[model samples]
Target: MASATVGVGWGWWGGAMRIPPFRTSLVVSGVLVAGLLLGGCGTGTAASEAGGGGETQGPCAASGGAVGAGAERDGVRVVGVVERAGAKESASPSGRVSERPGVSVTADSLPGVGAAGGPCAVQYDVTNPESEPFTYTITFSLVDEQGRAMSNVEETVASVGAGKTVRRTLEQAGHPAGGTLDAGRVRILDVERVPSDEAPAPAGSCPASGLRLTADQGDAAMGLRVVGLHLENCGDRAYSLEGYPVLQLLDAEHQPVDGIEVLRGTDGIPMAGGDDGPPRPVTLRPGERAVSGLAWRNTTEFGEAVTVPYVRVRAGAGADPVMVAPHLDLGTTGELGVRAWRKDETDPGAGEGGNGRPGAQGPYGGSSTS
Candidate 1:
């Protein structure tokens, strides 16, 4: 079998829905500042005893009860958690936590500083216990080596139906200052339940012509590369998209790459940014934009080179197909991965900080590949 990896790119057109990667780095940065204030002093250790007869407790000692590896609360259980280094491409499974009856949650090791020092990524597995669908938010707090919380917190929304399990990964840059994060100290700050049917109905299918696409190269490590896809609604009315886009690989001549496998986010592709919940209705008004994540690996243990020059994408079922030349070079793997569309606040379409309204350029200007 051929070794495979994934890649992503971004593009935009007139009156069309262009999907772009979400700007979670800014949120992480802001949260980091807030966390610093809430944490007061930085990680500090108390002085040792003069005679060394007894050890003095440090202020940075773990306070809150550790919640992982079989910890349960309010009908929810924490299976296990792991910490990953570098980009997710090189991430391997560790710290296995067994599943039990009732609702359970497990966190994959969150990414540390990438090779380029960008934000770390996180993936979570959430299982719903009830027969009905359940929507809730999960938050991650950075902890120091001393087992004290740091100045950074990241949260994502997740929805799982009864007896079903859903996995979600954080896309976007994360900057958790103060060295490596303590995987054991990382605990769930809150998990609020929300309405399962919160998503609004779509006005109609988004016309391909009304959407614009822009592609940009993103972070890479361990032979894995990321392409940021930005989709904007140039049409006059609102439009919505749920689920992953249909991606077909293309050769240098823009022809389909034969035997290339396209993997959906649910297929175990580690994604950054966006929520893990059921496709929420991201109703974009005229000029609003959304984002999607794409990843691919190019390294091969042993095989011929797999060259992918272009990619053709369909926003959703029945939407017109748009061809984008990401210029990705996935050598000999013949595999590409794509994530579902999520709202992006970094573009001009959605006003600076306001939701879905026209705003100023966010921390990330027009587009960012990292």
Candidate 2:
């Protein structure tokens, strides 16, 4: 028996035992090496595909399909998306979409998050279209252009009377880490209805006793001074506040200033924690505070000077009014404006500041009104 030479070339089994010619062996080895390389590349491509072609990255690209407006699922319709800084986008529901009787949902404009720690507000108009009252848990997600959710899926439970609408604002903190919130693409995650009798009782109104009202005047800009009305819950129990604080300017004689008119409006000045709906109840525990904004213009176009030596503030219509001697001078236009109550950055629930009550400062953190 003749001993055969088993020559190795580049880890290939070749060059012996009546194997093919050297050229043929080289060609075979090359094909084998190329095949291995191709296989490795194929594996990488498969891995990429498994991970969504590597397109879904960051916080927004979570594990949910793109949910468009009016794309009903789980018994709810996203009626519309109101962008805080943009226009309203209407949702077009599919013909197959069927809403649960006495259940409807709508999303409202989200105010931009400010330094004082305000949430992107979603005003939901939950309606009971039927003749009977119902309670429901409405779940939704604020998504970005990449179908990524900017905030966690939010849910709010409410009771709606028959053929009536109950409006509430759900606050979502923080923006998408990577993409912009596609306000037009809000998704309704779920709507679960229950018997009205099982619904939780509505929160109670904030009484004047538990609340301490203070005012802080912001820096004057363009003849307009902004005043932040701070309401602190001084009592041990939680208190809820909704709507604007009743305000009036007082002259040096401690009398209501003549020729001054307070207008209720939402525009003309930017305010932190401002929301665009009717007063929504804000529950404040002991030491917690909420803020409402006020603006007064002093300088008239004719250069007339308007000055107020004091201000009177009432938490609500029936609350006893308090007089504040802010001595803030508005250029003599005798016109003022106010914003609805909203959670301030210093709110205990906001978690931006420590667990102490917020000082009486304007939205811009100016001097204390006291």
Candidate 3:
């Protein structure tokens, strides 16, 4: 068999819908983030000690409870309530005061700083209203005092038990090239969760399925986009994969998106890298990963843009499906290309971030069509 360097068509996404509606995002200068930034951060909710007469004064300080607003559609909800980071809601710094957790969005976490070291940050209080433990991926967007959009961010919380609540601070990802951001508004955008045992990870405890599946933030320059879908054998057993990885795109509502095309190999959108050969059988051992891709171009003209927020992936037949949020914004291109499964050449070091493996990407020797 020849070592086919192969198909140039790169990626595909956004399922069918009757002429999707226009989608747009606003990214501005760091000035917005900085202006919205808080003075400092303490442990949880309001960061303050004792004040006059055993009182506590902080940004999240109790003033008839935190006040703000958010939107909830489908199963996703964005309500404002402060709790200790990664702690249960039963313990908010707003003086505890037993009460049912409210679903109203508020600005209690406003002007907050997160690990991102930038502005446009907010905290989330995740409550697992389910019966068993499950993992969650929550999406958030930065808004201004007037509730205009600024930036978006996402956080994945693994394994929350029934009736348990956890909190996390998520901030805008990076500085946009040019524009202006509204100060200090972050709200939940979406949330997609799955069973804890079925959640995918780059590296961690072995999954019940024997393999781990994860998605990498692919590159996007101009209108071209490329995202990597990876599968690694984490269990003791070897896993066999043949043909293309199955994919299902979902909207913010977690409903199936229709009409978008998923093409075999990358011929639809011509590109230099992520060449695809015919689907072939590949086996992965412990710590070994396989790489494929979802690529497309964001080209819109009159027609509404398609934005896919979630992708449910099955590495092989009968394999458990793991939901990943690559947030593909297919701008009316209508077609998406997927590369076939191939052996990844990236080295798995002492298990750093995500499965301990690295991506060489194009010409980096990270992937091979052998």
Candidate 4:
């Protein structure tokens, strides 16, 4: 496919809990991830970057694509223009048009890949400089020139090794806040890092306990919010569970959220599709999935409003604690309600309708691409 890409080094700030105080529209020239190589294109590297501040390579002599990329900050690089994805372009006189490479770009819209595309996405390089492995829960968003958030995507990068870096492509969910934003608006909203041992096991990975854990993006209506917590026996052994999962609300910095009480079940907060049924002894065989839920109200009545971005969960006593990001916008309610665990009976392959994520195995078991 034809391409239009550039490599440049730009830096930005990181924040906690919610969106950061400021945002950066970075143009990175680097890739640390290993993936399918383009059939006719050379692999990209920061060391091969061109443009200002370094030795440059003009657009690939034959194709206009920016052949290389550059530096990273806070262990991340937002490789400028990736897989242009065949979007029609009206070159802004300064765009590095893959179909006509050699042009330099300070800013331009990526028709189907950026704000022009219904789904906003970004490529991120996350590195763990610490000696031990760590997992990161990174929040990415699209914002307007006003700096107001248009849409947000939360993702988990599991087990980044000490001094090693990995890359991921994250996309926003639903129609999003602004529906669609303009170009150069992708920003890093927040980053929370935790020791791998303390982080939740990803859905496909089997931890020592032989189970995997994950939480949904959640839904809210009329100030009420509900998020599903999923657990599966990814290993060969059967796992047994009874009662509600233990919960801990955490701030962006990973500290316990104060003042919010953890209610035992959803009775305190009512909502549709909520399971108020009794907890039953459920044993999940290999490939079996169980689900629990969380409920809360974001009604602001007084004092200070609360927004928790993390939750530490354990299936039961003696089980490992898994960190889930249900992004509790608890308002000033000071309470979070939990639901008992029950075996999931939904067909694994069912789209679950609504805004489905691209491809199968997409996060949240989404059946379709959003």
Q: All candidates' lDDT scores?
A: 0.45, 0.45, 0.54, 0.54
Q: Which stretches of model 1 miss by more than 4 angstroms?
A: 1-208, 270-275, 347-370
- State, as a TM-score between 0 and 1, how close model 2 is to the true structure: 0.37
TM-score per candidate, in order?
A: 0.38, 0.37, 0.58, 0.58
Minimal lDDT window, size 10, model 2: 40-49
lDDT of 3 by residue, 66-149 (tens): 233444433344333232233222112323223466743222221222323232223445667778887876656655446655
lDDT of 2 by residue, 1-370 (tens): 0011111111011111112111101112323323322321001111211122323222222222332333345334432222222111211221233357796543322223231012122334565666666666554655555776544343444446777654343334234433233234456655545445433222232443767665542445455566556676766898776777887776754467777677675454333233365667777778766777666655556666767766768778876665554456766555667777776544243312211213332342322111
Please list the Cα RMSD from the true structure of every candidate, rounded to 1 decimal place.
22.6, 29.4, 14.0, 12.6
Please list the residue runs of candidate 4 whose C-alpha ends up more than 4 Å from where it truly belongs after superposition: 1-131, 137-156, 162-185, 189-192, 200-203, 272-277, 352-370
Point out where model 2 deviates above 4 Å: 1-208, 268-275, 345-370
* Model 1's TM-score against the true structure: 0.38
Model 3: per-residue Cα lDDT at residue 354:
26
Question: Comparing candidate 1 with candidate 3, which one achieves the higher lDDT?
Answer: 3
Clashes of each: 57, 9, 22, 9
Rate residue 272 of model 4 by lDDT.
27
lDDT of 4 by residue, 238-289 (tens): 8898988998888876789888888777777755233446677888888877
Q: What lDDT tens digits, residue by residue, belong to model 1 across residues 1-370?
A: 0011111222221121222222222213333533433432112222121122222222122223222333233334433222223433423343435567884434333223333222222334565666766555444444445655543333334346766655443322233454322234445554434334431111233443677654544546556576656677878777777777777777744467787677676344443333365556666778777777577776666777877756777778876665554556667766777766776656453322211212223211232211
Error of 3 at 231 (Å): 1.1
Q: Predict model 4's lDDT versus the native.
A: 0.54
